[model samples]
Target: MTATTPTPTPTPTSPSAPHHQPLLRPMDLAGLRLPNRVVMAPLTRARAARDGLVPTPMHADYYGRRASAGLIITEATWVSRQAIGFADVPGIYSAEQVTAWRRVTDTVHALGGRIVMQLWHTGAASHPDHLGGRVPAGPSPVNPRTRSFTTTGFQETVTPRAMTPAEIAATVADYRAAAHNARQAGFDGVEIAALGTFLIAQFLNPRLNHRTDAYGGDRTRRRRLLLEIVDAVAEPWDGRCVGVRLGPYLAAGDLFRPDAATLADHDELVTALNDHPVAYLHLRGPDRPTPDARPDTAALARYRHRFHGPLNANNGFDRETANAAIEAGTADAVSFATHFIANPDLVTRFALSRDLATGDPTTYYGGGARGYVDHPVSTWQDNPGQQP
Candidate 1:
C-alpha cells in the first residue's frame, strides 16, 4: 500500500478509457444495471448511533460520497437483536432503523448509485454484554475462541448455547423480516452474509457444529440452516434481488481452517446454490496467494467453475489484477473494500490510472467525519476552477 501524499490535481479523463477496460465496462447484475464492473464491498465502519443501533447522518454522508461504484453493499447490518454482536453497528429490525437507512439509500440514489444491504448475524462470535448478560446462540455449544467487538471493545468469546428447533425457525423469520425492511428502506437488493465465522458459516463448518439433529452432522444437514435462510429471505423480493456471499478460504486460528474438507464443503455449497435463483454468488478470494499459485487454483476460479451464476470476486484485488480476473473469465466483476475507504472517487481514479490514497488504520472503525468523509477526490488540472 502506498502512503497518502499531496499531489497536484490531474486532468479528468473519460471513465471508459482503455486502461483497466474490463473494470470500467458496464455490467448488468440480475436486472440491475451497473455503470462499471467495480463493486463496493460491504465494510463495517461501526459509525451508527449507539442508542438504537441506527444509521446516522454521518453514514449517509459517508456512503453518499462514494456513489460512483457500480454497486455499494452497505456495512453488515444486524437482522435482529439476537443477530447483534458488535457495538455501534446498524440494524434493520426497528421502524426507526428503517427510516434512518432510507436517508442513506436516498442519498446514494440521488447521486445515481446502486446500493444494497448486507444482512448479518454473528452467532457464537458474540459476547454476553451484547446479548444482555445472556450467552449468544449458535448451532452448538462449542466456543469459537474468537473475539467479539462489544461496547467494551474486543472481548474473548464464550461457548454459545445451542439453539433449539423453534429458535431456528424464529431466526429464519427474522431474516425474512429484515429483507422486507431493506426493501421498505429503498435498497436495490440484499446480500446474505454467510462469510467467515458468522452464524451461517458456523453452521457450514463441521468442526464448529456438533449437533446430531437436522441442522448439523453431514454436509447436507449442515447446510440446511443457510438454505432455509436463503429461501426465507427470498420470500420478500425473490432470488433475483438477492446475493449470497461465501468465504471458503477464510481461516481463523485453529477453530476454522481452510483444510481440504472445508474446501470440499464449500465446493458442494457453491454447486448447491445453482438450484436457487440467486442474482449472483460473491466469493471472497484468498487474502494472500503463494507466488507459485496458478490462476486456476485461485478460489475465484475454483468456485467459478462450480457455480453457474454470475460471480463477483472479492479480497485483495487491484485495478490490473481485477481486470485480469475478468479477462480470464474467472470473475464477472470485482468488489473492493480498502481502496474505497480512502478513495471515494475510486472508479474515476482507476479510470484515469491515478495513484490511490491509502486509508488511515487508526480511523478505519468507530470514528467521526475525518477519515470517513474527508478523503479528497482527484480534481481536473486542465479546469483549474473545478473542485473535488
Candidate 2:
C-alpha cells in the first residue's frame, strides 16, 4: 500500500465555519502511523545551549507546546563535529545530546505528538565566527556567497576547508551514530538534511561544488554522500524512521544552484531513495511565503518523478496554495514553517479558514516563549464568532 490514503481531494476549508479538523487522514510509513499529513519542517532557530550541542528543557517545551501538528520535525541537529556549521545548533553525535533530546521526545510523545530530528551539516555555509573561527568544511574549498545567522545579526559567509577522503568517511560514521542517538532520543524517526543549501546541498550543486574528484565532478558523484548517508542512517533506525529534505536549486542563504545539468542526476537520486527504506521526500519550491522570492520548480518535480514515498511539499505554500498542490497531486503532504512556528493550533486555523496568527519576526531566531508558544489556541476567545 502507498503511504497516504487514496483520497480524491486534499482537505478543504468551509468558508462559513471558523475551524474544523485539518486534513486529518492517516498515513503509514516504515512502521509509524501519521495521524495527519501536516508536518513541521525542521527550522533552525538557535535556542540550544551555549555549546550549540545540548537540548534544553525549553526545547522540549517549545516542541511540546506545538504538539498539535500532524508531525513535528526538530531543528537541523548536527551528526558530527565537522557538520556543526552554526553556533548553538544541536547535534546528535554526542551522548549528552542524546540524553537531552530524550527529554524533548518524551515530552512531545506525552502530548501525543510525533516528531523527527533532522540530521545536518552546514558545509561552506558555516562562518569562522560561528565555529571558534574554524573554517567550515564542504565537498570542496569554495566559499559561499551568503551570510551566517549570528547571535546578534548576520555575519559574512566564508570559504570553508574541503574535506579529505578520511574526513568524508568519518562524516558518514557520524550520521550513522546520530541515527542511533535519534532512536535513543525517543523520536518517531530522523530526516537527513539534504535541503536548505546545507553541507549535502553544497556538494550536490555544481555551482558551489567546483571539484574534479569523485566526490564532485558530476551529479553521479555528488549524490554519493547523500545516498550513502541514507543507507547508513536507515541501518539501525526503527519505526517509520527515515526522511530526506532536498532543496535542489533553492535560493535560500548561499545555497542557490541552478538545475540545468543536475536534472538527470536528481532523477537517479529520487529513484535510488525510493528503493530504500526511507518514508518520505521533503521538497521545496519557489516562493518562501515571504515576497520577492523565486521558487525551484525543477527541483520540486524531481522528487515526484522517481520517489514513491510520501511527499511533504514545503516552501511558500499558503493554505490555498498548499491544498491546491496536494489536490493537484504535486505533494502528498505539506510542511508549514513560519506559520507552524507562530500558530500552535495551525491545523485548527487552516481547517476553518480563520485568520492565522501573525508571526513575529522579532522573536523568530532565538527568544523565549514570546512568539514560540504564547499564541493562543483557536478558541472563541481569541478568534470569536468562529467555530471551535
Candidate 3:
C-alpha cells in the first residue's frame, strides 16, 4: 500500500473568524496527521455480510463519503468467532474479511482520509442466536441484564460462561491476531473497544465480574485482562498504533450504563492506564440527554489531570461546544457520533455555519445506503467516488 495524507478543503474565513476554533486545525494523533479535530466516532452500523461478517461495497461507500473526518473509526469489529455478538457486524478473523476491509481503507485513502479499525469483543452482551447457538464468553458468569438488538429482534443478554485460563490466553491471542489483520487491511491504527460492559469492561466492573482467580479479585487483577490484551497488540504495533476507549459515565439508550461505584473504579483505571505507552485515550463524557443529566465538570477535570496523553472527547457535542473543549485545553480532539451520520460534510458545515441535516433514526442501525451514505454534501465532493 502507498502512503497518503489527509488534506481538508481550504475554507476562506472572514476577519471575525475566531482563531480559537481549534476544531478546524490540523494535528498529529500518534503518528497520523489529521486534517481537523472533528473525528468520526466508531458507530456500530450493522450492514455487513452476515455469514462471513465481512464489509461490503456499501461499507466502503459509507466510510468513503465521510472521509472529511480527521479520523474515521470503523464499527466495532469481532476478532474471532467467539467474539461474535450482533448480526451483520464486520470481523477481522478471516482472510475474506481482511480483503473486504482493505477495500474500505483503499477507498478512504484514495479520498485522502485516515481510518482506524476498532477491535471488539461483545462478551456477555451477545445473544446465542448470533453466536451459532453457543454461549457467549465473559470474565465471569453474570448477566449484564441488558438486551442485544439481533436480527430476530431484542433478546435478553445471557449469563456468559466464565472463560478458563486457556480460553483467556486464546482471547488475548485473538486480539494480537486481529491487530495483525487490521494492519494487513491497511488500517492507520487500531482502537480497543473496551467500553460498554464488553469483555474488557465486564472484567473491570465488580458488578459483572465475580471471579476469584488471578484475573479477578482486586482492581489491578480485574484490569489485568485489558492490560494483557493491550500488550498483545502492542507487541506488533509497538504501542504506537493502539488506542483504548473508555466510557467513564455513559447512559445511552439500552447501552451499558456504569453505576456510581463503577465510576470510581473507572477513575482509578484511567490513572492505571497512564502507565501504558499507548496512543491517544478516547473518553465518552457524560451523556446528558435530559435537562437534569448534565456533564460532570469536576470529574472531567480530574480525569484530564490524571491522564497524561492526547484525549479525545465524545458524547453529544455540537460544533461550538467542541470548539470550547479544545480552546480550554480539556481535550485535544472532539469526536461526533450521530452528527456524522446526518452530515457527511460535518466539518465543512461547521466551518460555513450551514444548517446540518437530520438523519433518520430508523435507518441508523440495520439498513443499506439509504441513511448511511445517502447524506447529502453541499459542495465538498472533491472525489468522484465519494458520490453516493
The best candidate in terms of TM-score: 1
lDDT of each: 0.88, 0.76, 0.83
Task: Candidate 2: give the clashing pairs.
Answer: 19-352, 52-88, 286-295, 286-296, 289-316
Badly placed stretches (over 4 Å) of model 1 are 1-16, 289-297, 381-388
Clash count list over all predictions: 0, 5, 0
In angstroms, give how far residue 295 of model 2 lies from its true place.
8.4
Candidate 3: list runs displaced more than 4 Å: 1-20, 252-260, 289-297, 379-388
What range of 10 consecutive residues in model 3 has the weakest lDDT sum?
A: 11-20
Write the residue-wise lDDT of candidate 1 on 33-151 in tens digits: 99889999999998989999999999889999999999999999999999999888999999999999999999999999999999999999988999899999999999988999887
Q: Which should have the higher TM-score, number 1 or number 3?
A: 1
Q: List all candidate RMSDs to the true structure.
A: 5.8, 6.7, 7.7
Please tell me which model should have the higher TM-score, number 2 or number 3: 3
TM-score of 1: 0.92
Residues 144-260, candidate 3: write the lDDT tens digits.
878887898779888889889999999999999999999999999899988886788889877778889988888878999998898898777777878899886865333356677
The 10-residue segment of model 1 with minimum total lDDT is 11-20
